[model samples]
Each structure stands twice: as C-alpha cells, then as structure tokens.
Target: METRSRVLFVRAGLPEPALNVEIHDPDGGWLATSDLVWREGRVVGEYQGAHHFGDYGRGDDDIARRRLIEGSGWLFVDFTKGDYYARPRRLALLRRLAGHLDCALDPAGLAAIEDSLELPGPPVRPCGA
Candidate 1:
C-alpha cells in the first residue's frame, strides 16, 4: 500500500514524500509516524484498507491520531485502495493539496503522470470511461 501511494505521488510530479516518518516537535515529543508525508507542505496522507475501518481499535486510533496531528496544524489526506490507482480520485487528492497550499499545479504535468501509471493486480476500469 505504501509502495502504491509513493508511486502515485511520484508519477503525479508532486514533491516526493517521506514514508513512515516520525514527526516530533522542538521539545522532542513524539507526535506521530505518518505513512506518506511532505514535511515542508505540512501534508500527510494515509491509505487505510477496508479492514482498518471495521469494528477494531484501528478506527479509533486513526481518529485520535488524526485529531492530534491536525491540532498541530498538519493536514491529513485519507483514502482507500480504489482511490489510489483511479485517475479521477488521484487527481482529486492532488487538487486537495494544491488548494490547501493555495497554489495551482500544472495540469499538463499531472495529465502526463496519469497517462503513465500501471496498477498492480487484475484489471479495474478507471472511474469514468
């Protein structure tokens, strides 16, 4: 999942993010270890498989963890498997980043990336034909 997320960001020509990053404050307090993070953008994204959202502690943990992270002014981007490989969903993720940072990303650059991505596993059609 992390590999897929990394591929998505890199292919999109966004800033390559650090994976499994342990973030801390000036006082050395452990805030959280994010899945994929663009530290300078204060952006962190997580890919949660469906099981993680079930009747388990994982869901609660996610809620608390996101709250803690966001409280400190960091933004969290959450999505599932389908959102990763699909072009429209992936574009939405990038748009979120551009909006959050108040910048416009080059559409042509992202379109180029989307054209080149190859997903893992059997065929799943893109969100729209």
Candidate 2:
C-alpha cells in the first residue's frame, strides 16, 4: 500500500482507489478484498507481492478472485515489483490498461505529473556536485 501510494503520487491527482475493499458475491459471501478499487470506473488494481505466487493455494485463490472480478465487468491491472521499479514501463502499462477500458489518462496531464515528479531528468546529483 505504501508503494501504491507513492505511485499514485507520482501519477499526480488521480484519486486514490479504495484500498482493501470488499466485494460480495451474489449469495452474499465475501468474494474478495480488492487491493484497490476504482468504484465508479469498475476498475481494480492489484499489487502482487512475493507471496502471490509462492504457493499453489495462493495462486489458485488469485485465479478464482480474478475470475469473479472479471465476471462483474471490472478490469484488473496486476502489478509486481518489477513493474513498479521501472517508470516508463509502468506508465506504458497503465496507459494500455486505461485505453482498454476507454478511460485513458490525459497525456498533457500525465506530462505535468511527470514534470512534478521530475521523472524525465536524470537522478539527483550528489550534494558535492
């Protein structure tokens, strides 16, 4: 969730999606606790940490959760550490996913965000410099 918050900040003013959100099944049972839910857009974002693929049961649960979420007309974007570590790749993936849902991020707005994050430039120099 800390990482998600940082990413959201880097992306600028997009609303923080609801975290650890619960969704119910037709029979009223708990379907899943989505990491981040974009309620109005029916989009969900999941941050897949190390534990996600570590065991069979965990993997199976993820599959089942995805199936249920998809069944409800929501799109999910699954992210791993590698994705978060690379800004350009992450942005590209986000753009593609947003495009798929016809809710693309505004390019100008994104550029402003990048500028605010100082992302396009090289990393900050040492104090001596």
Candidate 3:
C-alpha cells in the first residue's frame, strides 16, 4: 500500500504529501475514504485492490458509490495493481491529470522533491490525483 501511494505521488508530481483522507456526503454521511485526498483540487485517489471486486455485492456497491461521488463534482482516479506496477502507463495517467488540472509542478521540480525524500528512484503520488 505504501509503495502504491509513493508511486502515485511521484507520478502526479503533487506539491504536498498524500494523506489518508475521507470525504463525506453533503449531508455528512460517509461517502468514501480515499487513500489520498487533494482537498484544494477536489480530487480523490483510490488504490483499488482485487478484493475491491471480490464479490458481486461489493462491486455493485462500489459502482453506486462512485456514481454518487462523481455527481457531487469530484474527480476520482482509481488505480489498480496493474497501474501501480506499470510505470509508463501510470506516468502517462499522471501527466494527463497534471494537464487536466493545470498543476504547477514541472518535471524538474518533481525530481527534486523525490530526491529530497531520501527513499529511492520514484516518488509518491499526491492525494486526489
């Protein structure tokens, strides 16, 4: 899970670190708990594991939840295991998102941020990307 989050941050080039966040419905009902939430950008990052679709009932519920969230003016980026493991595809998605959101981070800035992390090659994706 940490690896996935880190990859997302690196790919998205977000300015802030990804934090565990949850969004509630307008009525204060539980909507979804996102792996990362970029509150300023109104985006949600979801790391979907295979268990997310392990059952028919769960899958149906997920679909309904997603619809409700989307209707509420939030963009969700759902990443599966494949997306986390596949660098090119994941990076492409991140770039597309950066373009869509008009994010300020450039590749160099992102690289510097990743380097400062003191971890490894990649960086973590910001929340809400």
> Candidate 3 regions off by >4 Å?
7-12, 109-119, 122-129
Candidate 3 per-residue lDDT, tens place, 11-40, comes to 446545356777877778778776766677
Model 2 lDDT-worst window of ten: 115-124
Displacement of the residue 65 alpha carbon in candidate 1, Å: 0.2
What is candidate 1's lDDT per residue for 65-126, written digit by digit as tens? 88878878888888777776677887787778667645666666676656545543332233
Q: Name the candidate that leads on TM-score.
A: 1
User: What is residue 32's positional error in candidate 1, in angstroms?
Assistant: 1.4
lDDT winner, 1 or 3: 1
C-alpha TM-scores of all predictions: 0.76, 0.69, 0.70
At residue 44, candidate 2 shows an lDDT of: 76
Report the alpha-carbon TM-score of model 2 versus the true structure.
0.69
- On TM-score, the stronger of 2 and 3 is 3
lDDT of 2: 0.65
- Relative to the true structure, how large is the alpha-carbon lDDT of every model? 0.73, 0.65, 0.63
